[model samples]
Target: MAEQDGAIYDRLTRVPERDWDKNAGLDALLNGAREPFVLRGFVADWPLVQAGQRSAADARRYLLDHARDRPFTVSIGPPGHDGRLFYDADMAMNFRTGTGKLGDIFAGIEASEAQDDPRTVYLGSIDIPAHFDGLDEANPIDLGDRDPLHSVWIGTRTRIAAHNDFPDNLACCAAGRRRFTLFPPSQFRNLYLGPIDNTPAGRAVSMVDFDAPDLAAHPGFVAAMAEAQTVELDPGDAIFIPSMWWHHVEGLAPFNILVNYWWRDTPAWLGQPQEALNHAILAIRDLAPEDKAIWREMFDHYVFANDGRVTDHIPPAARSVLAPLTSESAGRLRAFLLRALNR
Candidate 1:
């Protein structure tokens, strides 16, 4: 019950106690619950067979056997400087030594060393049939040519700072537990994002510190912390974190194993327009406070019009620009933007 961080972390309150058959498919679990939902004890059919049974030795062997053959990248945590830790590039490089054995490489390492090691491992395009032997069908998610079923081994009690990914991710634990802190899109203002356009891999600054955050430095974080929600996941259970929701994950136990599936939606490309809106904010909206205020007012007129007749405000000539999306129409719009940019 101890609160170590600024955010509140707790276990699943409503654990389903029934022991249903282990071979149950994921259709019910995936489709029954709506978006932004959490379910306890949802285990994947294929991986659950070897769950808790796979030893650290087996995992190490698997990683070494596949390291040179695949597009796998290892994250060995970050580096330490003046007692404050940052991601280290050297430790990540050490994985290349000694055929990458877990015991040989990670033995006698302090928590700070593990945290700074850049050996964060990611196996890209894992062949499903090759990885998980004797699986009938692929999980509904498509992970390119790589296996949709993948595993993540967290060696230390590591912290994954706040960020969001493109696809909907379903993370199931095979060993140990993890604590997840989540915030909806509306809470972005509270999250205090570092850079609007930087990739997640490149973001180096953390928005908030749970142990001892400087309230004076980040005044808005206080309001955001009040609205945050947390969930702790146990072994044999899974959590679905939808697209665009900011999440911060912490490995609570050592030798943790997580198998996750990342799936994209057909309309996943909606973010392109949102990215354009962000660019518009930078190019036009942020130029002057008065112009920003005017743009906000106009946006309200278009988005919040109760009469459902804001289309009336658009001029006849500009009507085509706002027309419904079609392949041909989209092409014309792209051409128009290109011409405008070139001019």
Candidate 2:
């Protein structure tokens, strides 16, 4: 019985196989239509290379030059911190702002560039041809981009602590091997996040001690650690991290080059009035302890419960809202949300 139980746990916790099924899981999660999913080896087409290659050098140069041209923000690591940022070119300039300063910056860039460029990182969208060479026959996932998605992340090793992004990210290592410690969105409680007011860098938190973690201090973290996944990415090896999954990245090597695609499984509702509700929550309701507590309870009631339990609460009138869970239901819910939101 013990051996069988262990096997079942392993099957549930181990990374899923990289295949269509897993990809479906990722797509479902990104669409907010399903639970967390793991897609392994989804980016096997990316070619890996060592640090000395010209491709790596070119990527680094492009990143630094782009960052220099733009008013990019930077986070300098304090002394004795494991954070260090270095670029092959001296053109890389550092910009530091107080917490929450970069929010407007991120909003502005996304507004102007038609792409997400939070954290002052240079992100080349996936539709540009300059980024992908042999993608024609690669059976690539159609992310509606004519160009290959790429980005250059230049930051101190400890600059970005830990957080999750809204869109699914496929990051390719070009110059350095970054050690990524990933936790599913379900582990958010264990992370102990910072303030949400901080923009670009949102809700900073460290999942584990760099040198030593006091397990006693955070007992819940032990379960989080048990479910934690680690990947050391070298040049050419890309990691497909599902949307909203918490991650901490340590730049194991200097001049780290990373190209990534931030793709959403669903279309974004731009210029929607519903955004006002989000703003109101952040600006007002979130401040009141009673209101916040009520909101938290609502989330726990509707969002955190198992699918079986929560699905029952979804009314037939709102059944369409739950249709994202399956392809058969997506159209109904999509239309419903679109109409309901008047978007």
Candidate 3:
């Protein structure tokens, strides 16, 4: 991340690009992709893309016209930090957020763009259907039975630290140029993660600065770099990021806008894995080694096994929680956990 910036970018594998027209629909493509891929000119026909292609002003107008005139949250990062929205020395957020109409926010962003070193202005994870009127109908991807959480991201030139999310992402660059540096889920140990609960965003992000990583302090990052995949997306290009894959994003253009879809492969009622992790940390993390080992064996038997070892001992009707979980069973399990934790 020092003298090796160009080398790192050059050595990394570019994310493969696919043709959306030539291939199957989005859901099918995603089901097969298992990894991140680019779709060049995927949404070139969309009104949003055409508007942005004409001018950023046109794009802003298009969005404002479609928007419901509701106040939207914007993240404003102070200048002098190289446009990176991260933390200060005290681990507090480096950016302040305020809500404004899209037009006002875009005006502020435009003003900032004129500055030599502009303030980082970002509007992230905005629910498209809730705030925008008829845009979802006008510009839509056929996700085919998968009702994803459609969202939009708007920002000036900025850097977002590497982070993972629970739901897989399909990110479409509606306006401006953007670069993504992605790492596999296995690179967890090398990414030098920040505090889990107190994150800049909801998801935990890598503490390492991609532009200038301190390799000596974090030697494992070198291994992470070896596995990195970097790709730059132009307007109308899209990328598929598998759930839990670490990604560092850069808004290359002065004004950038992205539309993304997020959804889990698992059903909604199954419960969040992160909560289970927190509960495990509370219950098992500090246990004595021998006790921990026993608990690990118990977990393997109960939660993480496929040998039919559990069912071999129990009858069909008696295998209540052990059986395939449905919405009802998951609800019951949550209720049981709450009662147990409270006791």
**Candidate of highest TM-score:** 3
Which regions in candidate 3 have their CA more than 4 angstroms from the true location? 1-7
lDDT of 3 by residue, 138-248 (tens): 897877777799999998888899998889899999999988999999999999998888987787899998887788988999999889999989999999999889999
- Writing each residue's lDDT as its tens digit, candidate 2 over 126-228 gives 2323433343233244444323344445432333445787767766565556666678888878866544543334334553453445667767777776777
lDDT of each residue in 167-208, candidate 1, tens digit only:
667776655567677766567776666655543344322456
Rank by TM-score, highest first: 3, 1, 2
TM-score each candidate.
0.64, 0.53, 0.95
Task: Candidate 1: list runs displaced more than 4 Å.
Answer: 1-35, 48-52, 62-68, 78-156, 199-206, 264-274, 297-321, 335-343
Against the unseen true structure, what C-alpha lDDT does each candidate score? 0.51, 0.48, 0.88
Between candidates 1 and 3, the TM-score winner: 3
- Name the candidate, 1 or 2, with the larger lDDT value: 1
- Cα RMSDs of all predictions? 6.8, 11.8, 1.8
| Residue pairs that clash (backbone atoms under 3 angstroms), model 2 | 83-158, 84-157, 126-147, 126-148, 126-149, 127-146, 127-147, 128-147
Model 2, residue 170: C-alpha shift (Å): 0.8
Q: Worst 10-residue stretch by lDDT in candidate 1?
A: 90-99
